[model samples]
Target: MNILSLGRSLASFIVVYGGIDLVAVHAFAPLRSLSADGLPRRRLTSRFSAGVDLKQNEDLQKYFQAAEERSLAQFARDDAPAWLQTIASLPFECTACGKCCKTIGSVYLSSEETWQAAELMNISSTEFIEAYASDIIRDSAEASNTWVRLKEKEVLKGTDHSPACIFLNSDTNQCQIYEARPTQCRTYPFWPNLLASPDAWDAEVRRMDHDSESTLLEWTPDAGGCEGMMILDQNSTTLGVPMKDVYRQLREYRQQDRYFPTGDKKADTER
Candidate 1:
């Protein structure tokens, strides 16, 4: 490589040879000779001729190209960088694996929502409570804060507590009362509780249900950490309109406080 080809008043670069860093120490001694590895040393004077020979040296060419790329990525404005945009889309899409609907905490709805859901199903509120819901006190301070809690059935084998929501269709793995579903049902995995960490996108920690519970781990801590997550790209679904509607409903459910999870007083726990 012609190091002095770059006509400049002052220039500095490191030439890597045999894993050793050889630098031009001074104008008098442009480079230190090292013949231990059978590589001839370079010595060139720093004199300006208004010409740059970065193209001749592949390493220098790559260095300047990478430097230019980094500057653009760091300084460009008005829009996010390409990599940032890709990351923003991450841990967000719900493939409707229906896992969240199945493996979930208690699903509750306001009294108004209960009535609306009941009416949509062409049933009286009294019958709805008896068949699908139970009354629960939302707040202990006042007796007026009562909400309807949806029941869960079809417990996952080997786990007593893991049950699918009662409204979930066993045949299609889709919500039966999707349009008329409760507000709580409307705001699903989007719950502030799950937003505490990006890691929670797996629908509850690193264990994203490796197909079957048996393959979760194998004689080691954090062994299956790389397993795929529950959420997926919106385009990953092939269920057509039904699946598309579910994603559309979720996007509409996003509230102003969607970024914050529960426990922060400013966060609106109920969407």
Candidate 2:
């Protein structure tokens, strides 16, 4: 390859590897550094749900890719957890409850999302940025980086109290941006399940009901079909939706939680 091409490749390798190293170092640091497991964790805010913070676990790809690659065959072999089985069997359809969309979170836009949203609204990306970007100052950085959140429930001088989602159309209780909706939304129900940590699973189950543990454990493998869900692994990502990409999106929110606490005033801001 040309010198320029080789140099670019090396730069990319450095950025990715360096970032991975940083993530690995911090993965267990908080738990170890403070010597307090009671440290407050980031909770879900707005209309968005939180998932695994893969940035904290540089090895996350191995597990997620495993789920994507192996079929239902390997689930039992790997000693996969029961939550995946329970979710696979449960009828967890969205039901278009609109419960989720009504209270939206600060929506982070992907590069593609930014472009598409601009196109859909027939507005310049700059205009979109001005209207929806959330200001975040990274502690590691001197200057603030621009990020976007979904518009609040109320905009347009109080005339539009509708959910500010460009994709949310309450009239139909549907996401106009459904197909293009962030990967985060598509992985619901299975998310906290796919995350598969015992602590994380227990906490989420407690939200749905206090008595879910026994049932969740029983449904994991032999009886229910959720074992099939565990079939997702790296190879699966290659064929369908990339699991790493989804985890990356969730990781951003996870990492941001360090700075933004749950139930903070900003979360309660009137739409």
Candidate 3:
């Protein structure tokens, strides 16, 4: 039975790798409830699922993308919907499948995040901007804080690839300014918090879900620490636990003050 019909929240179950104690990281609110006749019914819009309000405007894209990543990571858990309850009970763990980070698309950086990245390199923001940040219209439909950094740049000479990010230390394959990295980068592999609609979600799911003989299975991790693997682990299953409330809590959690890569008190956090 579709858990949505039974008034259950759809959650993504996740298993972290490298021998960490399993803790339930992300979950959603129940979407349906059981009926008296032993069947499930969809919760009404007024009280059922929180309607997803997708933002397509370019100005909001990065912020939206960050949110989408967090949300999708939350949903990618093995405990998320579609997986049976039995699978949910199993102690799942990520295998460090770095497929999520390699060959990744653009990772947007906010003004504050950009500045912090510069500091990590012990360079001024001006220098960093000259080296990396470029004003580009990522989306014409909206006025986003659009900036692009190259990762995996095709060498002008022999076939060598490098990332656009100055903070990426080649030997370590890690972000030098991870504490201050952009929210989008922090929340890789799961981007639905930025792209809201289920339809958009369906597209991403189709893009990432590995099938036999799929080229995606051959992918590699972009960096060390396997942080994004956490995201991939989140997306790996469909346990369909209720996650709306969980997301709200996470959003609230982001409000607390913390040191970022660029500097302190760099972001408003409310956004």
The number of the candidate with the highest TM-score is: 1
State each model's CA lDDT, in order.
0.44, 0.39, 0.36
TM-score of 1: 0.42
State TM-scores per candidate: 0.42, 0.39, 0.38
Clashing pairs in 1: none
Count of steric clashes across candidates, in order? 0, 17, 63
lDDT tens string, model 3, 46-136? Answer: 2222432113223332433455556545544532333322222211233334333343345445455566577677999778777775443
Model 1, global lDDT: 0.44
Where in model 3 is the C-alpha error above 4 Å?
1-101, 136-166, 193-216, 220-271
Candidates in order: C-alpha RMSD to true structure: 23.7, 14.6, 17.8
- Which stretches of model 2 miss by more than 4 angstroms? 1-68, 71-82, 85-90, 120-123, 134-146, 155-166, 193-271
CA shift of 264, model 1, Å: 17
What is the C-alpha lDDT profile of model 1 across 1-271, one tens digit per residue?
A: 3556432212434422222232212111101221222122232222211233333556665654454344324332322222222332334344565655654455665555567678779999778888987444354554544466677775657865456678888788798877666545554544434433444444442344444565343212212122323433455222222322222233323322232223233222222
Order the numbered candidates by lDDT, best leading: 1, 2, 3
Q: Estimate, for each residue in 1-271, the C-alpha lDDT of model 2 and write its tens digit.
A: 4557545543443354443432243342221111112111222111112233333434443443353334223432344454333332322223464434544444555434555566667788778667655543233342233334555445566563544555567678687656445433544434433356534423332112234544443221112222122233334323423333333323333433334333233423312
For this target, which candidate reaches the highest lDDT against the unseen true structure?
1
